[model samples]
Target chain A: MSAEGDEAIQRLIALMARLPGLGPRSARRAVLQLVKKKGALLLPLAEAMREVAETARECVNCGNIATRDLCEICADPKRRTGQICVVEDVADLWAMERAQVFRGRYHVLGGTLSALDAVGPEELRIPRLVERVREEEASEIILALAATIDGQTTAHYIADQLPGTSVTSLAQGVPVGGELDYLDDGTITAALKARRAL
Target chain B: MSAEGDEAIQRLIALMARLPGLGPRSARRAVLQLVKKKGALLLPLAEAMREVAETARECVNCGNIATRDLCEICADPKRRTGQICVVEDVADLWAMERAQVFRGRYHVLGGTLSALDAVGPEELRIPRLVERVREEEASEIILALAATIDGQTTAHYIADQLPGTSVTSLAQGVPVGGELDYLDDGTITAALKARRAL
Candidate 1:
């Protein structure tokens, strides 16, 4: 590479390295591949990213990413099932959607309440969630947050805020294909305590 | 994500999945991070890719990537050491440069000759390499190709094409940090045969 375009390539690699699962070496390899297949990969990717940057925004009602003020779920009248699934992030909401079981709307907290990081309800959009539940007259609130202490604390706080709504959580037990030997002590205990009549 | 921006995000993820070392799952994760940090990562990466798409081109002389007609190594007067290191790809040239040991110019062949793949000498710039060695009056031609069968065959063919010039290959031995127990039989045999006195 020469002085003219080398900096651009290096900058791309550095930004790519900052992505979630990529490091410096993989970033370099990816950049080289992009350069090699400029027409097939590089240009199209650039255009796609540009379009996303221009249009993507958080939905006003649910915090899910959308091009408009409301996400698909929030905009659709059929999804008003009076049920709200509370999650830590948009990615978690997407995961729940992919499962095809959740037919209601979502409430993205953005993050859990963390005392050490000084993150509270205001920082996470929790106040918005509380207001949304009341305004929407949701019948049930499902906590799809992580099993961490902070996640549970946030869930409890939300439940307390919504006194009349029924609150539930995803079951904690052995996964479908999980083996007993590989299971952690907490999971095994939970599974045993929640054993069915089978 | 909604209909308006979902396609753009999905297109970015598909393009990212095509990159080397990235699968669909990692591509989704990377795209999420880019969307989350749009100003810091997404827009900058898009700009960088666009710049590279406009300026990056293969070096006319050596097949190395460059903004100008000639790559930095090929254009540098100090690199005219009458020694042309032959590599199978531009990545190999960059690897040699990273070591900072080779002070000579390079010739990237683009790929090794493979009869199975119908890649002839003409397809890999072999004729150009021959003409270059003769025109430049190169003293030594260093073969920095892989140790694979096709690589050795290509090296031998190149040596035969330029009988007058001294041609040498990288030494076959245990890698700097490789364990002897982990070495294959062929490498062990080659190391024993090429053993030097202490």
Candidate 2:
């Protein structure tokens, strides 16, 4: 294989290896399977990869990914109200929607503030979130951050920043260190309903 | 939403719904996610999908899907060794290699001949397989087919077709009605090397 061919394959392997649960061996197996199923699966996936790589951009307002400059959620006039549900990541936003309980827009913090990792408000999208509240005139902010120490610290920092805004949080249904992806829709719904003012 | 928006979402939902274990609700969630990630993950995936849909073709001889008319395995001189281990599907062929066992070549029999579905050798690549055996002057034909009733029936049919050649089969260690995906690598290697003559 040419260096280019080998590099393309290697680039794919490295990216795949970074996925949540995949390792080098599993990534190789998956790549091989995709190659064999290229007619039905791989080629299309590659095309999708290239297109996303070219067109995908982060939502400037809400931190969600968007094809356009602004994400659909931030652009949609109907979704913008006083209420903004704050989440740690895009996956959490998806989990919340799966519950079919929330009718409000989302504010993805991207990640929590971690002293261990030297992650600050800037790294967590908190500054952008503050701008969203001020510009959009958001009435209420729902903190759906994880129950971990870093998550709590980040939430506290955000709440302090927007002291004038109503702040509530998802209630006691989530287990410690439980990622939103692992929770079923019903659990998410129940947690949203039981949310208390912070 | 406009008709175009609904239609695009609907097409995506349908494809996601057809995935192995996803339901309509999950598909909808997934599509919404794709839309949200369009700039990052969705557009690329769609472009990849379109490309795959356009370029993928199945190997006419062995039923293996490929980028061209013949799969790499079927076309490679290093692969053909007068020994073809028949498998129920592409997944089975992959599982065999995860163990790093099989070295010759593979014939993916799309599926077993089932009386209930009215499937027969004519529906599978059995005819092409017979022709390959004769033309390749196969000395040994190994059946790594599944253990379902239909699998056994197909095996018997193939054994009869290549009566002149030495016919060996994967051993009886496979649990009844079990797909090869669920088996461990050690078990598959043991099964392949200790394969008994029919």
Candidate 3:
């Protein structure tokens, strides 16, 4: 490789390595594949990346990503079920959307309250969420946060802030298709305590 | 997500899925990360992708990736060692380059001769390789193909075509750190047969 070509390829590989899952080795392989299929894969991927870079934006009302001021779920009139699903990030909102169970709006907190990172309610969209509860007149606020300590702390903080609203959380039990052998002690105990009629 | 935002994210995910190592789930995760870190990752990655898409090209002489007509190795005056390492694809060439053992030029065949796939010498760069050998007055041609059946067949065919030129192949034995217990039967056999004195 010439110096210029090598530099370009190295820059691409380095950028790719910074992605969520890809490492240096995998990034090199991905770059090689991209270079090999320039016309078919690389060009289209470049175009798509450019397009997303230009259009993707966060919704003003909620933290969900959208191209406009309001996200689709918030903008749609029929989705107004007087409920809002609160998540730690946009990925969680997408997962909830994929389930197609929640016919309501979403409020992304961007991150959970972490004492170690010094991330508090103000750092997230918690204040905006409280304002949305009043403006939208939401009857219920679903806390779809993780089961981690920070997740629980954030959930409790939000619950305390909302006095009149009904605050709920996702059920903690034996997950669907979860094997009993793989279950931890805490999970087994929780599953036994939350056992219901079959 | 609004319709436009959803479309852009979906398109980006689809394009990411077309990459060699990524699937639907990982593609979604990668796209989410890209969207989340737009200013830091997505925009820069998009710019890099566009740069590569515009500049990256195949070397006219050796089929290696380059921005210009000749790849760096072929263009460099110091690398003229009168020896050419022949590989099945550019990936193999890259692997060889990573080892930094071979100082000679390379000839990428694009693919091997596969009767099942109807691939022949004409389909690969076999003709161009023969021309390069005669024109460059190369003393040796290293057949660094895989240990597969097609690889052996192509090696033999190329050897038959080059009667006067010295032809060699990569050693077929247990890898450097490979254990006898973990090695396959064929590899163990090859290693035993190719054993040398300490």
Candidate 4:
């Protein structure tokens, strides 16, 4: 509230501080970094931000984000391997795709089912997912959910709903304390390859 | 030619991949994160980006960025404390300010004067800083540049410019293989307090 504080920079810093790994000071630094590289990076990133701001939408069928009604993976005819990799969120979907090994599609659950916060199936895309499976005649549903209790609970629920459908999960790749974003492509690839029935 | 690519998302991903520490994969996840947090953080950050896109300018005096012709630090009349803390970039200046210790003004050099990249004194804020030393009638000039080779080279050049003016360098509270942006406020405070005369 001092006369010395710069409001605009402060706003930028506050927003950036909320990013997953960045804190206040690092946020300030990141904003400054973007400012410095404005010519090549910042300006373009700014434009992309605007475009995404206008266009980003949820994939109607799978709950992954898309500019269109259906996400690219969902829309792609080549991607229907009769399988759907169910993830806790879009980041997980992107993480699986980043490995470049998954030829199937994805269903982002939006978030894990949590009783602590009272999050339930209706709050997520679970209903839409069962609908997708019925419509797509999916053979397998891969539970790529995190190893957390909530994730496991969500997985079991989804598997139970799809009675005859086989459920599988990525294997032996996620390091302890490592987020999906940090895992290399090769590890994700190996995990996807060695996936076991759940 | 694959059906799984969202053009806009792909473009965003491509652009983000080119950034310093981010790659294509990380960019995808980051974009997803932005999308998920759009209502809370991304929208406001977008607005800030637009504002900065239109209004952000470089401080002619120190090469630090501002939303106006002069940055807040440079615009303040009472901040001219005779001592100008010279830094390699705005991140350094912000880091100094976050410590809430440097009462003096700052002169962001934009970058270290580098001959290897054909960077000259004019490319940096050297000329303006020299002009400032005379204009501001500064007593002690503190070189808070990084300990990198280029940073030291720039520091020496600045020291040589003002023959009679007293100059000093920040003490080694700065860690080896450390960046100013990464240091905690406490470390910055300690470094400034233990500053030694060059």
- Name every residue pair that clashes in candidate 3: none
lDDT by residue (B30-140, candidate 4, tens digit) is 677788777876678778766665677788777667767787777887785689999887777777877888878888887888888999998887889889999989999
In angstroms, what RMSD does candidate 3 have relative to the true structure? 6.1
Please provide, for model 1 over B52-89, each residue's C-alpha lDDT reduced to its tens digit, 9 standing for 90 to 100: 89999999988888888987788888876688888887
lDDT, candidates in the order shown: 0.76, 0.71, 0.77, 0.77
Which one is best on DockQ? 1
By lDDT, the candidates rank as 4, 3, 1, 2
lDDT (tens digit, per residue) of candidate 3 on A78-147 = 9866788788887667666654556778899999899899998899999999999999899888877666
Ranked by TM-score, the better of candidates 3 and 4 is: 3
Candidate 4 fraction of reference contacts recovered: 0.34
lDDT tens digits by residue: candidate 4, A74-184: 777887667888888776776677677888888888887999999999998899889988888899998887866788789888988888888888778866545665678
Worst 10 residues of 4 chain A by lDDT: A1-10
lDDT of 1: 0.76
Q: Residue B78 error for model 2, in Å?
A: 3.9
TM-score of chain A of each: 0.85, 0.89, 0.85, 0.87
Roughly what TM-score does model 3 have, to 2 decimal places? 0.86
The alpha-carbon lDDT assigned to residue B124 of candidate 2 equals 88
Ranking by DockQ: 1, 3, 4, 2
Work out the TM-score per prediction: 0.86, 0.75, 0.86, 0.82
Model 2, range A2-78, lDDT digits (tens) per residue?
11113344455455444334566555455545555655656545554454455556788787766678866767787
